[model samples]
Target chain A: MIQMFHVTKAYPGDPPVLVDINLDIDKGEFVFLTGPSGAGKSTLLKLMFLAERATRGQVLLAGRNVARLRESGIPFLRRNIGVVFQDFKLLPTRTVAENVGFTLDVLGTPRDEVRDRSLKMLRRVGLEHKADVSPLKLSGGEQQRVSLARALVNDPALLLADEPTGNLDPALTVEIMDLLTDVNARGTTIVVATHDATLIERYQKRTLRLEKGTVVADERGAKAARLMSQTA
Target chain B: MSVASKLAYFGRTAIGSIVRSPFVHVIAVASLSLALVGFGVARIARAQLDALVDALGGEVELTVYLAEDAAPEQVAELEQALTQRTGGEVHRISPAEALGRLATQLGEDGKALTELPQNPLPWSLEVRLPKAARDAEALGELSRRTRALPFVTGVDYGEEALVRLGLIARALEVASLVVFSLVFLTAVIVVSATLQLAIFARREEIEIQKLVGATDRFVRVPFLLEGLLQGLLASGLALGALVGLVRWLESSAAGPLAFARLDGQLAVEWPRLAGELVGIGCALGLSGSFIAVRRFLRV
Candidate 1:
């Protein structure tokens, strides 16, 4: 679970990326952060990932004040949260299996276990056949799945994805959503930031919508939106 | 990762990366070899000159000639007077022997010189001093004192050879110093640039490692160790080159030293040359590693 109280992040030579934003995510809850472009979606994900600091206010992850924690403690926080980037920042030099096992490598997991676990996850993502191939040579959709497999390999308590399906075809997008749903059903907290209106409508998860660094709409399923999603 | 795990990880990466870069290794090894060559040449030249100085050690003997018809008592008086004045031994150079030695030296240039009439050479006293006696001023003063002795026609202290050899010694020292300084400067630039480029290539890796919970020292150790290993390899290569150079010098003794007039065995100081090569090789290795590591670690 993560909590951000009045978290505002400002960068040099630019306006504040996130305004006094207050958000709380309870344990085991699947939440969607739906917003337009430049609405602080990536900035919000970065704050949670400890890739950048909030200029003001507190961010607590798993009951620990991450905003106030030392830089040395950030790795411990990151280890608990698996993150997927929009571009699926996988090392091109590594094979699919090696990519998935990198998280375990960071944890100092034993060699045989890292191989077995990574290979198992690759099988789940239907990339078992591509296990020996470099991620650079994989298609966009295949690469995205590899990233998702890597993130979920450790079965982190919290999973965060920044536009995971942004570049995928509709079919691949649905496949990834189903994968995320399965991970969530197995008790991983999932928070996805995306602007795909139809997908969000279909999924019908609780949404936090942001516009211009402020939360413009924080709501449950609205009347017309709910009916349109059920009919679809 | 635990310390051991991280160390093993870094060690594998470092070795693997270096082995992959043959061009860089070649350049580094060449740089090391070149620096050692300068050191080797300087060392050998210095040893040779030092040996020459030691072997021929200017406690020189000047043969002071007597008038050819001088009486035995006069020669005795002169010898006594010369010894007292110079505070050293003065032995008589028999007229027959002095003539014979001169004939041998001048005779090499001509058989005609040996056939000259009645060997008109003078009996002389070979005045010798302890090894402590050197320096132009002191030897000149001793020469003047001997000239004042009875029947001492002149004091031949071999001043010309002493002056010329002194100049040669000074010139060798200057040449060696110039070579040493140039090579040392080259090494500094080469090592610093290598380390700087290494730091650049691995900038993101270093940042990622730091984020993944590496301490500053742990982050630094592998690169530092890489530089150290490079230095050691360079030292070995340089040492081999230097040893080959020395061996070649001894074999070809055909180089400039072979042409030099000094007794080859007496003038070539093998022990001193060996010591110098060892010192220079170790110094370059240690200093290059230290400088490379310190420069990169600062940031």
Candidate 2:
């Protein structure tokens, strides 16, 4: 679960990126953060992951205020949160299996177990056949699946994907979204930040729309239709 | 994870990095070998210089010749004084003994010495000082003290040769230190620069590792291992090259090198030298990797 009461984030000599944001995301929930470029959707997810700190107010995760967490505590906190990037930050030199198993490797899981679990996760993403191939040789969608496998390998409680389908075509984007939905169905809280209104309209999940450093709307499932209508 | 598993992981990752970029590893190892070779050669030369100094020091002695008409009691007094002052053996050579030695030195032309009207050789006390007093300054001081003794006519010591040898030894020691420092600096810089390139090549991997919740130590251990492996390989290569070089010097056109003729083998202690070289290589590698990885870890 997460909570942010009056959180404000700013860089030096610049206007506040996220101003007076008040929000709450409950456990096992799948939330979509939709905003235009420079609208602070990624910044909000970064704060939740403790990758960034709020200049004012507290941001709480799992009932603990992460803004007060020490730097040394960040990694342990991140262990419970999986992040997938738009560019698919897989190590090019590593095989797909190695890329997927990296999270377990960081946790120092037993070698056989790491291999087994990584293979299983790759299978779930339907990329087990490509495990031994280099990420460089995989298609963008396949690489993104490997990234998803890596994120879910450790069974983290929360998943944050910043435009996970940004580089994919419509078909691949749907596949990625379905995989994310499957992960969410397995009881992992998910927050995906993207500007894709089509995916948002199609998914019909709870969408928090941001504009000018403020949450302009918080719509759920059917209510999301009204917000999209207003935007149009 | 258990320590063993962690180490295993680190080792595999390090070796994987090296395998992925053979050119970088090769360049690093070659540069390290060059630096280590310079240090190895300098160490051997220093050992040889020390041996030479020891050989020359062992041969140093002072001969205090008594006055031609000196009385027996005065000669005995001078001998006793020298023995007490130097804490060394003082052998008294009588006129007969002195003439006998002179005749032996003359070899084939000694027939005229036996027909002389009277013995002209003066009695002398051969003063053999300890090794500590064999240097130029110490021997000079000892000679000055002996010449002022009663019944002592003159003192003959290898002053010029001892002084020259001492100067050479001192200069060689300074040169060895300078060479060692220069080589060490060069090794560190080259290793650091090479590791910097290696780290840059793997920056994406490092960033991925960090994002996946890998501890800083977990990320750092692989680079450290990489540096360590480079250093170890470099050291082995340098040692092999050094042994080959020494063997070549021994069998070269000029005949066996004087230093390599130490009891029919090279003067350097192979095992100890190898150990030291490897230790230095490891240190250089560790430091280089540590420095190069620091800026990247900030992310």
Candidate 3:
């Protein structure tokens, strides 16, 4: 579960990026936060992921007031939340398998388990043969899959992706979305921020539409029941 | 696992990565090793020379010039004063004895006695100190005090001996300073460069780990271990190299270093050198990690 009440964030001498925004999502719900450029979607996701602190108000993640969490505790709090970036921030020096194993490595997982799980995840991403190669050597799509494997490695309860399909071809976009759908089906709450209108129109999932740092609509129709049931 | 064990685990991961690219790691280790080797050699050499000089103390003597036409009473009084001043147990070769020594040292043709009528060599009290001929400070102080004696016209410290002792002292002082600076510079370079590499190589990994619920300490712990390992390897190499150098000097150019030897060895205190290397390794390890982690942990 994720809840944000009247959260506001601003940089010095700049207008507020997020202005008194309030929202909530039940356990296991998959959300696509749709918005135009500069609509504070990424900032909202960042706040939820604990990458950036709320300038005001409280963010409660699974009943804990994370907005009040100290800087030292942020990393521990972030363990339960998975985040994927548009750029696929994989370590260039590390092989694809090593990249995926990083989350478990941070958790001090046993070497055997890290190896086995990393190999399995790479197999799932259809890049098992490329496991020993650096992520930088992989194609953008393959790298994205590696990033997904990395994010999902720790089996986080909450997942956030910033424009996950921003660079993918339409067919690959469909594939990536299907992959995300599969993850959601397994009951991981997902929040994806994107500006792609066609993808939003096609997926037909509950959309949180925002403009000028405020949510304009929370939409649902034919696919609402499926969306609700897909969550845990 | 505890934090330290977790650190060791991650440290193993990092070293595995580094060793997989053996060339870079080896070169890094070698550079530090060579620097430490040079430093250790220089340090050992100075210590050996100092100890050698210290052991040679009694061989050098003060030539005490007596007054012309000095009476036997004045001579006896001077000898008594000299003996008492030199802590009573000191070597005081009389002037006649000095002539006999000159004759023995110079041989028959070297005996100037036949050429000089008044036995021209002064009635000197050859105060042979029981210490080595290295530093001029104590000798110079003695000369100043003896010059104040009435029967003692002047204290003639062999000019070459004084000059040589002064030179040795200066050399020892300068060598210590230069070597210390060099070792310190090497440490800084080793630590700074090692940390810089860690920062650059793991920049993205560090950022990602932070994003994925890894704390600053978690991120820093492994790299610190890596730095420590590099330092240890470097120090080990340095110690090995220095010990090799000393052994080589002792067994190879035994003649030259024979002029200066400490504990019967050429250069370098092997045991102390080993300890110093290990100490430097630990220092480099902790210092490098501390600096790198502090910088990276900053927003």
Candidate 4:
């Protein structure tokens, strides 16, 4: 679950990047945060994950008031939220499996369990055969999937993605979206930030469109439920 | 992860970082080792000098010569004063005894009839000072006091030799201080600079780790470990080199420099010296990496 109450974010000497935004999403929902470039979508996701703080108002992610969270509590809070970047922020020096297991490793998980869970996640992402290979050796799509496996390896309750498929071909984009849909079916809430209008129309999900720094439209796609269920 | 697993990860990461950037690591290690070797050599030299000073100091005795025409009572009074001042034995050498000592020193040329119309050697008191009173300053003070006595003609205690030895000791102390300070500073700079480059190379890795919920401590431990390993390796190399150097000196030159030996061996405390060097190396490594991590790894 995610909630934002009139959240405003701004940088010094610049106009607000996000202004007076208020929204709510329940558990297990897959939402598309659609907007053009520079519409503050990434900033919103960052605020949800505590990567950036709101200049004003409050953000509640997974029942915790992120605005009031202590600095030392940030990591534990982050453990409950998974985030994927447009660039697929995978370490080139690490094997694909190692990259996926990194989350659990930070949690101080046992090596055996980390290996087992990461390998299982790699299988889920259809990258099991590439587990031992360096992420640098993978294609763009494969790397993105590796990144996805890493994000979801710990089974975080909330997954925030910023242009998750931005670097992928149309076919690869569908592949990543299908994986996301399956994750949502297993009870993880998902928020995806993107500027791809075609995805907005094709995915048929609850779409919130942004312009400048404000949300201009909130459209709950009529066929979203049927499409997501069919895909799952 | 268990504590053991965490430590293993940190160790592996540290080793990997070092191997990945061998040039900078090697440079850092070599510089630190050379600095430590300089320190160790200085310590050994100082120890040898201290032993030599102690040996010479123990034998130092003051010879107080009486006035040529002083009476017997004057001689006895001077003897009592010298004994009280030095708090040790004061043996009186009569004119006859002094002459005999000179004759024996002449070594078979003694038939020259004591070398003069009359026995030339004066009555003297050999003042044996306590161990604490053998330093140059104390001996000089006692000599000045003795020379002011009415019956005393001269007080000689090899003052020049003692003064020179004192100067050498002081100079060695200052030199050790300067060497240690410079070496420590150089090692810290080398390590921190090397670690800074490693940090830059791993910036992406750091960013991802933080993004995925790694703590600041988690990000920092590996760099600190890397610095610690560098320091340890440098110290090990320094110790090895110092041992080899001492062995070489002993085998090839100990016979020529017999006085440098202490109880048939060098006076170096190998275990304590090794422990100190290792401790210093660990400190240098920890501090250097701490600085680098605090500045560069802003997570």
Candidate 5:
């Protein structure tokens, strides 16, 4: 769960990137953050993850104020949150299994358990056969799947994916969205940031549309649910 | 994760990084080895100087020449006084024995000494100072005391030479310390720079690790281990090279050319020396990586 109250972030000599934003994301909710480039979607996710501090106002995660967390406390807080970067951020030299298992490794998991859990997560992402191959050798879709596996392997309470399928084809985008939906159904709250209107329209999840750093639309997927209900 | 598993992961990552970048590793190792070798040479030189000082300090002797007109009682009294003060055995050399020693010094020309009408050499008491009393100041004090004794003509202990030897020994000690410190600092800098390069190369990976909930310790321990391994390997290599060098010097023309035959006595204590070098290597490695990681970890 995440809550942001009137949050504003700015750099020196520049206008604020995000302004007076108030938002709440409940547990196990899957939400889409849609905007063009520089609409501050990434900045918002970064604030929740404590990757970037808010210039003003308050941000809370799971009832804890992120601004009050000590530097030493950041890593433990991060352990409960998983992030998937648009670029995948896979260590090119590491194999798919190693890349996915890196989170557990950092958590001091045993090697056998890490391997088993990592393989199981890779299987969920349909990349089990590519576990031993370097991420560099994988296609764009496979690489994104590897990133997803890595993010979800620890079963973190919250998942933040920034343009998870930004580099993939349309078909791959749908596949990734379906995987994210499955993960949310399993009770991992997910927040995805993207500018791809088509994917947002297709998935028809609770969408928060941003323009110029301000939330302009907070649609609760009622229309999509009605359409689905009629189709069923 | 257990501490053992964390340590194993760190070690494996360190080795992997080294294997992945052999050229960089070689450069780091070579620089560290050169610095360590310089330190090792300084250690050997200091040890040799210490042994020389000990040998020379033990051999310091004072010869007291008795006045020609002095009576036997006065001579006996002076000998007794010197024996008690010096805490060393004394040997009395008669004038005839002194003449014989002079003849031996003159070599084949000693027949001329035998042709003299009378033995002109003065009777002397050679007092060998105890090792503890052999310092330049102590020997000078002893000489001054002996000169004030009745029936004493003069005391000869090569005072100036003793003073110069003491100065040399002190200078050697100070020089060794300075050289060791400078080389140790150079080694730290070399290792730090080398580690900085490695960190820069892996900056992206480190950032990713941080994003993936890795603690600063988790990210840093591997680099520290890498630096430590480099230091240990470099120092071990340097020690090996030093041992081989000492052996070669002892067997080659350089052995006889050296100031002192640096055989077993002047050689370094291998076990202790090895332990010290390795310890220094580890310390250097840890500090170097620690410094190098600071700039990169700000992200």
Candidate 6:
């Protein structure tokens, strides 16, 4: 769960990127943060993940004030959140399974469990057979799936994705979205930032539209909410 | 993973990275080994020089020869004058005793010395200064004062030459320290530069690690391991090179240049010096890795 009140983010020599913003995301909710280029969508997500601090006001993640968090505690907080990027961010030198297991390794998980869970996650992503192959050799769709597997392997409570499908073709875009929807159905909160209007209309998730550092509209897709409840 | 497993993982990844870029690792190792060799050589030279100065500076004595026709009384007078002037223990050597010493020095050719004209050697006085009077300036003054004795024919102490060599040895000691310090700093910089390249090559991997909630320490340990491995390998190479150099010098010590013979002067404290070199090598590696990680890896 995340709550931001009167959040403002500004950079030196530039206008405010996100100003006077307020929003709430409940546990297990799926959110579509839609905005044009440079509309502060990514910046908003950054504040939630503790990548950057708010210029004004407060950020609360799961009832903890982020601004007051000590530097040493940041890593522990991040353990509960997963992030995916447009570029996949997979290490080409590593196999798909290693990529997934990296997060578990950082947590000091047992070796046997890490291997079993990583392989299990790869199977869920329909890439179990490709687990031993280098990420460099996988197709864009497969690579994106590997990235998703890595993010979700730790079973984080919240997932923040920035333009997760910006580089994928339309078919692959839907493939990733369906995977995200499936993850949401299993009770992980998801916030995806994008400018793809068609995808928004098709998925029909709760949408928060931003323009010039301000939230212009917030539309809860009622039909999508009903579908999610039925799946639960 | 367990702590043991984590350490194993870090070690494997570090070795893998090094293997992936063998050329870069080789170059780094070579540069570091050369730098260490320079430092080792300077350190050994300074130590040897210090030992030599200490050995030669001890047991400093002067030998003054009497005129050929000087009377026994004159010799006695000169000996008494030397004792009073230097406050040193004086031993008189009669001309006959000097001739006997020459014959003994001739060894198997003592007969040839006996065949010479009768008692050609002169009476001499050996002045042995106490430890307190061995200062260069004091010895020089004493030598000058003894040469002015009317019955004295010649004075020999080699004090001036020893003083000059001591000055050169002192200068070399300072030079060696400066050279060692400079090379050590330069080696650290070289290591830092090399590691920067390695870090840049893995920037994407690092970014993904950070994204997956890897702590800064988790991300840094691999690079630190890599630096440590490089340093260890370089130090091994340097030790080998130093041994070979010492052996080669020892083999050639029998050549015409007598001064080139170390005469066991190069028998350094091997275990201590090796430990120091290894310690320094590790320090250089760790320092460079830390700087690189701090500068480039924001996490």
- Candidate whose TM-score is highest: 5
Model-by-model lDDT, in order? 0.72, 0.85, 0.76, 0.81, 0.84, 0.81
Better of 2 and 4 by lDDT: 2
Summarize candidate 6's per-residue lDDT along B148-231 as a digit string, tens digits. Answer: 877778888777765775586668778877887887788777777876776777787776677667788988999889888888
Give the runs in model 3 whose Cα sits over 4 Å from its true position.
Answer: A12-15, A167-179, A222-232, B1-8, B20-27, B48-99, B109-175, B240-266
TM-score of each: 0.67, 0.87, 0.75, 0.81, 0.89, 0.80
Of the candidates shown, which would achieve the greatest DockQ relative to the real structure?
Answer: 2
Once superposed on the true structure, which residue ranges of model 5 sit more than 4 Å away at CA? Answer: A222-232, B47-59, B66-92, B127-134, B255-266
| lDDT score, candidate 4, position A187 | 97
RMSD of each candidate?
7.2, 3.6, 6.0, 5.1, 3.9, 6.4
Per-residue lDDT tens digits for candidate 2, residues B178-211, read: 9889888877887788879878888888777777
- Model 6: residues with Cα > 4 Å off, grouped in runs: A167-175, A222-232, B47-59, B62-159, B246-257, B263-270
Better candidate by TM-score, 1 or 4: 4
Q: Provide the TM-score of the second chain in candidate 6.
A: 0.66
The worst-scoring run of ten residues by lDDT in candidate 5 chain A lies at A223-232
List model 6 lDDT by residue over A145-177, tens digit each.
888888899999999988888767888788779
In the predicted model 5, the residue pairs found to clash are: A108-B1
Lowest lDDT block of 10, candidate 3 chain A: A223-232
Supply candidate 1's per-residue lDDT for A34.
73
Q: Over the stretch B67-142, how does candidate 5's per-residue lDDT look in tens digits?
A: 8888989888888987888788889999999899889999999979999998988989998877666677877887
- Would you list the clashing residue pairs of candidate 2? none
Per-prediction interface RMSD?
4.1, 1.1, 1.8, 1.5, 1.1, 1.7
Residues B1-299, candidate 3, lDDT per residue (tens digit)?
66676766877866875765566567556666766676676677677767766655545666678777768787677667656555433345566676777788888766666566666566666665544433477667767877886767888767576677667767888878888898778767865775566566656767888888888888887777776787788898787777677677778776666655343366445787788887876676667667866766642
Model 5 lDDT, residue A180, Cα: 89
